[model samples]
Target: MEITSVPFLNPEEYSLFCSFFQDFDNDGETSVNKSRKIDEKNKSLSEILEVIDETEIPTSKFEIPSSEFENRASEMGDWEQGRVRKGRNQSPATFHDGETAEDGGGQRRRLWVKERSKGWWKYLDSDECSDGEFRKAFRMSKGTFNMICDELESVVMKKNTMLRMAIPVRQRVAVCIYRLATGDPLRTVSSLFGLGISTCHKLVLEVCAAIRSVLMPKYLKWPDQERLQEIKTTFGSISGIPNVNGSIYTTHISIIAPKTNQEAYYNRKHTERNQKPSYSTTVQGLVDPRGVFTDVCIGYPGSMSDEQILEKSALSQRSKLGMLENTWVVGNSGYYLKDWVLVPYTHQNLSWSQHAFNQRLDELQMIAKDAFMRLKGRWGCLQKRTEVKLQELPMVLGACCVLHNICEMHNEEMDVELRFNLYDDEMELDSSRGISVNALQARDGIAHSLMHCK
Candidate 1:
């Protein structure tokens, strides 16, 4: 090709010549001094026409004008159109086609990245859907959900505005309740609630803590004197047992093996078919005649016997100190016979009055057992292996017990499936605690009264 030097070509002519080199491959780095001199003057059109006429340069190569080519010089190599995109300080040749050598080697360029998921909490919006959807999604009636939200608002609501907004207290409490009601894993709850996994975990703990601290006292407590009289009357109606203050029992909740003390949480009695320790936590409950929990003692290791749990409990302290007075709480053979605690005679031989006492005691025991059944039934989370950390499981279970009472107050229907298939922890006979002389006299007195009065 003949090269010609002319004072800059006219605008139109320069465009035409520049378009001709668009297909040339400009691959790999070249120093500034050795780089192509794109600013240099080019031959006039008349001179380029003479060269094209003499040489056999293919016409097909430059058929398409530069105006028609897409600018892909940043990442893709245009073999036909060899032009390369350039950095501000670096020449186009400083980077090979498709090589990520810009702004130093292989470091990722900063980008406007969005890490949040949008509108996951939308499911809780009442106006967006039907009441049935709300109940199914949150596992509670809208009214119940809102009531809980209102009560928890003061505690669960965020107080800071310093950073990204905190999750609304409603959503936070809902996440915790929904997890408990459904026994769903944290990941599932997080996805359903449109929260991060860590956020969901935090919310569960926070909400449970709030429920334990705020609602538990209001819902689950030792009945006052008047309430105690009412409870005794209810028990009397169920069976002829007199002075029955409450019924007591224990149920074990499954948990993952603890990292701190694996053996402590291991309930040897709950061994798998292969005889492996099944780790669990025990929740001991005292229920009124209506099958509502009045008192709950949670966080006892499953390995601890029921009598041990009861002896160490506040209820026992209250009873031993004469706080209960004439009031007597009934349990199965698992508890020691005490002046304030009545257990059915487990001896093989029995008098007719003793037989009558045992029968009435069995009825009272069923009331407490059924309370646990209804509790675990209503909140299926306790039925399954609770995935919460061992330390947090106490508050979580305590919260569920409180909710159980609230649900009972509101007449929340028991889950039919769980009601029939309720789990009952086996009871052990602790008859060796040596029945109190006063307790034995009281039991015989009640039995004699029942026999003669009837």
Candidate 2:
């Protein structure tokens, strides 16, 4: 009630206090009427507190002695104390359309300012950053990144608000890309992108979802009738294997050992061979002649062999329904010999024709292997164990595969530094050697023709 006893008022506080005098000083009002007007104003206490909050008043200007507050607090009963926080915004001051100034939470939400660092992100986003630096940081050329952002803009874009502008789609995408490219922890990504750690994590998942839903169906999909014919012709020239639609390979992406059914995700082969613990999920990809994935099956447990993964894959289901239509997809010895699938012989002794056939077929398989290497290399998230949960790993993996296809389609070359040996320290799946009666004849015919031609 006494301005002289209080510290200095900021402009908002000064204006607020001045309004009381301007209202109460009007001449003909009874005490009861004046009190009722004051009560009506108090009904908008929530919004008034908000206006006060916008003024960054120095704490030093408002500090009260601890002993004075302690003495007052000791005198207050529970009902009075609770009243300090009650009934705000219940009869809010509304605008023409009845919108209130503050949220429905009233005074329940804590008021504080968060200071986020922007130095790293600022440099990375500026012209002073060299092309090499930008590429190294985000693992893609500026053009490629821009193209991806444009493709996802409609879905990944957010609406702005009165309090703060929404982060631009490019920046949101950069946060996601940097996280995926470097396999950085959310803490590091947050600092680099000037975002909260949880925000960084959320951006990656959101962008990955966008990529899966929007870009993946366009960039990564099974070949059509014409595309299949082209692929078969290309494979025929490479290894004299006719009707070879694509080369398929399965690779494991490392993940945190999940709590439920840990053994299911355990890689016994990798653990035994490397003499250490390992956990992963399987990603089976069928790549065309240019090493771009046309079909991918992701999120199978790491313990599943390539044969088992293939069986569970959509590719197998389609093949069983005669969708493949007598075309062949070649895999290594880890897969079973089937009418629509070809595998290299794995016995200790092999005839000259069988070895020749194996070598030629292996050349096609290597296309897929090399593609996997570049996929892991360019998207570093797939190289190391990721923090994404088991259930959501599919979107992340599928996003990587789609991006890899986009890069390949664009003729984007991987910087030599990003090259990774996916096979190094990785154990191959045990061969399942299942045989089909008709497959042997098909393989024998191809091997004889190939041997004779060579």
Candidate 3:
């Protein structure tokens, strides 16, 4: 008798093989231990043949009854071998991560639960989900989501599934926007939205870029003459701030320290918040009287002064070229005084007219502060440290402003509690010098006009 080459066996088969030998040994030690010690000469030919017969019988019918097998083998295999490999065809009776495979009927099944998949989308569609919850998760109402989806579906819609099934455009956009609106970490967004972290990160940039490309021109722009006049009327009614077109301000959006030019993004002001060096980027914006952004200029380093940023802004260039002819865009003293751009009077020895002029300017300056407060409040992502890369931060900022405009247009009610509280730094008086002579005359003229109106 001889042992022949054996084919590969499943864990059950392998376990049965070991069990057969154990049963034979346990039944009688002489059949196992004594047989191994017997010399060839002392062993009878009949005994050798009997031993071979017993071994051949089990090997011939290697398959055991299903009743004979237990799940212990799978458990032991996992404990001893570290991980138990399962057949691709096996289906788990119960599924979750770190779960052990179980024998179901005649088939072995693995408990493989896919992570970051399902649940959220279905919950969003269900009646059990509340509008408040939806707004908290998505930062917009269902109507707004559907509205945006209709506009952006063409660009972000999936056309092919060659590599893997693409996530639906609505979910992709919702998850990304939720992340941006909440400023949550990628993992937090992934877990909450039921998406892979990498997928969340990719979709965030994809959706943000899509938003900027599609919505920027429509929502965020310089108002047309009619709209400008409308805005001017609103400002004029505020405190006789005549010919007022828009109010400009610079708000800082926090970001992680950049890999290159780390110092450039480092925010000198945020250092005291955590008692450590921090980084942020300045978002210079000009808003209409309704607290909607009309002009947005992002991507400047945090360390740059408002004067420097305004000097380099397209609005400044346009003003210099008479694009803003006979318009008054008021700003805080952080900005330099120009004929078109007006800032509050900063003289220590101020007359009654000058005081009245500064008072009116201060009232106008609240527009910028109120605009920023509402913008950050409505979209909380801007209120905290954003995790986007420096190169992509401008696009993210632009998309936020675009959405802010959308919310304003649709009369989206802001969450008062979520609004960013004004810090002392936000209230700091600007020390920029050198007002233009023409700009000085303009300020004095407005001041005298206010006095006469009084």
Candidate 4:
């Protein structure tokens, strides 16, 4: 017997065979009957294949003539040209080349650069540019723009989750205020960002309130005994005194009034037609020699006398404590009180008064004057209202004192002259009007003798 081999079917033929077999139901239990049916189908398929292989047709039987072929080609060309013409007529006017479309009865289209004049390019709206030209003209970095857009999208999504309505404009306005308080000018800030001046002003006030509510408690603190001791040690070197006595400085307030009279102005004075006296709030602050603000009292009427302000100040109570029994305090003649506070150069010397008591009192006055002169050099006249309101004034004064003490401490031998001018230009003596100077001098002499014996 001779062995024969059959060639494998190509991909197309195998696919077709698989498709035919896929239609059969394999769930039937009659295996013999199913096999017989499959054999019959295979026989039919083989016979069809054999017929297709053996069949032959005449090439010229169904061929068209060359003239007919050319005629069909021309018909196709005509049909295509007609279709193109129909398309051009039905399309939008905006889509047509070389024709500008009006805004009415058509979509508004951006004008191209070539359609515009040379100078008109400068005035061209941003919407009129190609994507590339717009990006270049705006000078935006691709990465930065995308990152900003993404961040905005994320913020919008987060906001929408909790809010049913849009976020209010004031909530965004608050952000502007924060920038202003932290040191940004309102004019330069919102101009580029498209915000109005009034909005910026309100925002600044709101932010200031918020920050003050949080920060005021921590930064504004009262000084304790420890801090007072520290201040004493710091001022001691400069004053050449073993301990520090209290001091007081005075300042005034500024009142602003319009140059021209307005409806708001009411003239209290009937005689003086042009005179309008302005008014301002008066503030008094008591600070230690080290410039640590010990107490502050505000809301005194501008016309209140300096003596009245001092009498009401917390320093008045401190002075009553008898701390000045052996110590000295620095102040102007405004604080000149006989018994409680020591007005400088008020003590009298007599024949019985030891020379040492007079010398010590003179030395103390000199030291106080020296400190005042140094303060005056650094701070000019504290009487000025505008300069006092500058927030850095207190800090500058404190820092200068610290530096002065440090210099005095490190350089002990350097002799510096005391430079304060006395407030009273002339000494007044009235022997008959009051306790005679001679009697006061005798009392001081006795006190000094007793002090030396002790």
Per-residue lDDT of model 4, residues 3-59, tens digit only:
344445667767657755864576654878677768876876786588657656444
322-385 per-residue lDDT for model 2 (tens digits)? 8987889999877778899998987878999999999999999899999999999999998887
TM-score of each: 0.72, 0.75, 0.74, 0.33
Residues 1-454 of candidate 3 have per-residue lDDT tens digits of 3335644555664565555555445645665555563433234434544554556444555554455345656655656755535332354343322334444445555433465556877798577988888887766787888898888998888754222346788888887778767888888888876777898898988989999988888888888888988999999999797888999989888788888998887777778777998887888889887889998788998877787888888888888888788889998877778889888877699999999989988888888888888778777788777767778888888888888888888877776677777542543445555657888888889899999995
Task: Provide the overall lDDT of each model, using Cα atoms, as 2-decimal numbers.
Answer: 0.75, 0.83, 0.76, 0.41
Alpha carbon deviation, residue 323, candidate 4 (Å): 9.9
- Among all windows of 10 consecutive residues in model 4, the one with the lowest summed lDDT is 262-271
Model 1 steric clash total: 4
Question: Where does model 1 exceed 4 Å of error?
Answer: 1-124, 127-133, 136-139, 159-163, 272-274
What is the full ranking by TM-score, best candidate first?
2, 3, 1, 4
The alpha-carbon lDDT assigned to residue 326 of candidate 2 equals: 81
What clash count does candidate 4 reach? 1
Give the distance in Å from residue 70's predicted Cα in candidate 4 to where it truly belongs.
56
Model 2 TM-score, all chains together: 0.75
Ranking 3 against 4 by TM-score, winner: 3
Clashing pairs in 2: none
At residue 11, give the lDDT of candidate 1: 71
